[model samples]
Target chain A: NAGVTQTPKFRILKIGQSMTLQCTQDMNHNYMYWYRQDPGMGLKLIYYSVGAGITDKGEVPNGYNVSRSTTEDFPLRLELAAPSQTSVYFCASSYKSGRSSYNEQFFGPGTRLTVL
Target chain B: AQTVTQSQPEMSVQEAETVTLSCTYDTSESDYYLFWYKQPPSRQMILVIRQEAYKQQNATENRFSVNFQKAAKSFSLKISDSQLGDAAMYFCAYYGKGGATNKLIFGTGTLLAVQP
Candidate 1:
């Protein structure tokens, strides 16, 4: 299995620019998430989807939007990007939640975004 | 709100020695999950180990193990026989159940350097 895959390993956007970070997982996981990591910091969730057609905001969702039209894809759209958006973005997938399920997340190679 | 904290910003260990990275969390939910992730220079978020709130026996994966203290709300990762390849940024994360999406709260992270 390809597990989780993210497109454009690196990207740079100028102020007011917009771009969509693409994510896909072949593991057929029901839970998917988007997280951003600033330099020298841990990751913070931006958005997540429980299943197709179901998406929700996470801890940090400003300046971003997400849609889960399919189980395998969850793309994050950044509108009018700013310098604060410069960070490494990661896409992750995990199994369904349960008392017995540890929800061990499988992550994709992150996309390093630099917004000028 | 749940929060994960990694007090150590950086830690160094001899190639053959063992080192423990500290992590503490605060959560109101009784049923939740904790995780340790390793991000190498390649920027891949790899799951190092995980522990369930209800499990008394700490989680272990090969040379990696977690010291989970439920009462104290602490979760620490121990790397045994550290090697150069073990050098990476380690993050502690918390996931509470019953959320619309299984959102994970992550710590600021600790950079681990395994010196020869």
Candidate 2:
């Protein structure tokens, strides 16, 4: 099902440079999320969306913005990239949230970003 | 606030042996979900196992199983007959039902190494 897919497996950006990380999921999930993982560290949430056109900030949302224009796509845009933003980024999606529904998230193959 | 903690940063076991990775979480919510995710060198996050808080029986998937202790807020993953393919960084995550969006909080992860 190509559960979740990310683009630009690796990238290097300079200070103040901006770029967008692409993510797509064909599983028709209603919840989408973006997370970043630093070396030897756990993942931290950056942004998420409950459905198309509705986005919210997560635990670590600075320097990043996200838009969920469609159910299959959620793109993260990094503005004025900084060293702190250099990390591996993952995109994930899940079905509608419910008490009995299976909420297992499907993750993408991550994009490695290096801000110089 | 929900927090997941993985005390062991790294662990090693001989191939075909069993190894357990410990995890502890803090949450006030009674109904929630717990998960173990594996990230291999390819950088894809894969779901290893999951457990629902209300379930009394441990969740098992082939060679992977979880010992879930609700009272102690502990969830540990056990890899039986460990193989080289099982070597990866494992993360414990928590999802509470309090929020409208199902956000996941991940632990600092434990790196497992299967020695031949």
Q: Write the per-residue lDDT of candidate 1 for residues A56-113, one digit (tens) a residue.
A: 8888999999999999999999989999999999999998855445557889999999
lDDT of 2 by residue, B1-62 (tens): 89999999999999999999999999999988999999998888998989999999999999
Residue A42 shift from truth in candidate 2, angstroms: 1.1
Whose lDDT is greatest here? 2
lDDT assessment of candidate 2: 0.93
**TM-score attained by model 1:** 0.95
Global local distance difference test of model 1: 0.91
**CA RMSD of each candidate after superposition:** 1.5, 1.2
Q: In candidate 1, which residue ranges exceed 4 Å CA deviation?
A: A97-102
Q: Give the DockQ (C-alpha) for candidate 2.
A: 0.64
**Superposed model 2: Cα runs more than 4 Å off:** A97-102
- Please give the range of 10 consecutive residues that has the lowest summed lDDT in model 1 chain B: B95-104
Residue-level lDDT for A49 in candidate 2: 92
